[model samples]
Target: MTALRIALLGAESTGKSTLAQALHETLPVLTGLRVARVDEYLREWCDREGRTPRADEQRAIVEEQERRADALAVGHDVLIADTTGLMPALYSEYLFADTSLAAPAHHAHRRYHLSLLMATDLPWVADGMRDGPHAQAPVDRLLRRWLREGGHAFVVVQGQGPQRLEQALNAITPLLKDRAAALPPTSPSTVGKPASGGLFSRLLDRQARLPGSTRWTCELCDDPACEHALKSALPPATPRVP
Candidate 1:
């Protein structure tokens, strides 16, 4: 199975690390597969160096983020990344007026199946490494712009702590089921092709054609939203009962 790589992203202190860990721990139990994680390398760099990265260091940060995420994805059903290179690249541009490191970050962003954008609505907490409390808003804007312009499928995670975790799980349900359906035993005879609306909709269309396909995708059907989204995404002729 192609591991589902989900990025928890946004400005600093938006709980990307917290949510990444939560999902990393919870998802495996839900999917019955090992879940792995790659956290923010730039923060590790900053902690080690005792200072924010210089322009020259930005490339290394972005590159390392990609390398770390790719490395952990092996032999796992899912890889939860705290942040992609896009964070450092976005920060480089927003904080240091640097753009050179962004291209590679954009490339890495494409590798993620979904990005859970941490909403900047929560109260900002100071972690000595963050630029300043005021820095989050503008950076949040840039992150949203990047996701939008990049055409990546993303959902903003709101609420606090556990509520936030639940939202992330909700957003990922379709993907988890899709990944399950994609595992071995799947063949040209059972798989479906792309259709309208989006990836989820297309997958549902294909899923409708195969017997027992619902068994693969319905593991998370207890959640009304997941159940409804799956059925709604399917073609009208194949309306599935939850």
Candidate 2:
């Protein structure tokens, strides 16, 4: 089976770490896949650097995590990564400020097959190192932007810890199962399609079924204008007589 990479991403104090740990404990029982957290790798890097890491350090941290995850993914069928405090908001902030900070090497949008975004509904509990005030609004905005940018994700809200864990498992299980099943079987004989039809035929068939072409029409509406007309234009109003 091909490796499954799942990334847990969201703002701080949103329980990303807790959820990652919960999933790590639960998923093995449900799916029999080994899970790894990116935090473990980050801590190791911090120790080696012998200093608190800045945002720039996250780039190297995430890259290392990606490399480690990719290598381990081959051994285990699935790997879940707990990502850093890098979200779309941080990316936009850098962009707006015109700062020189480059995006993290292993961006969640590109690296993970699935990303779980924890919501900010729960009260923020700051551990000693995380002393900043609750940043719910900013985090929420960032999460919305992240989803809009076209990543597969789910927003886990505040609830019973066990219930949240169950919900997360349910949401991810089908995706994992479907992807695992879709992987092409490893057999030389099945490498290519049958010789009865060539690749051109498949391409032509796809072209014939394309929407907005003469070969295919709107499935919902019978009139072409119904599909193409501007929503702002209402039917012509009768002229008022004077």
User: Which number leads on TM-score?
Assistant: 1
TM-score of 1: 0.75
lDDT, candidates in the order shown: 0.70, 0.49
Provide the lDDT at 183 for model 2: 45
Best by lDDT: 1
Model 2 CA deviation exceeding 4 Å by range: 40-52, 84-108, 150-152, 179-242
Range of the 10 consecutive residues with the lowest summed lDDT in candidate 1: 233-242
Clashes of 1: 0
Candidate 2 TM-score over all chains jointly: 0.60
Q: Which residue pairs clash within candidate 2?
A: none
lDDT string, candidate 2, 48-141, tens digits: 7775466555555555656666676665656777763244225435325423322443244455666665545357776544425445555556
The positional error of residue 154 in candidate 2, measured at the CA in angstroms, is 3.8
Off by over 4 Å in 1: 185-242
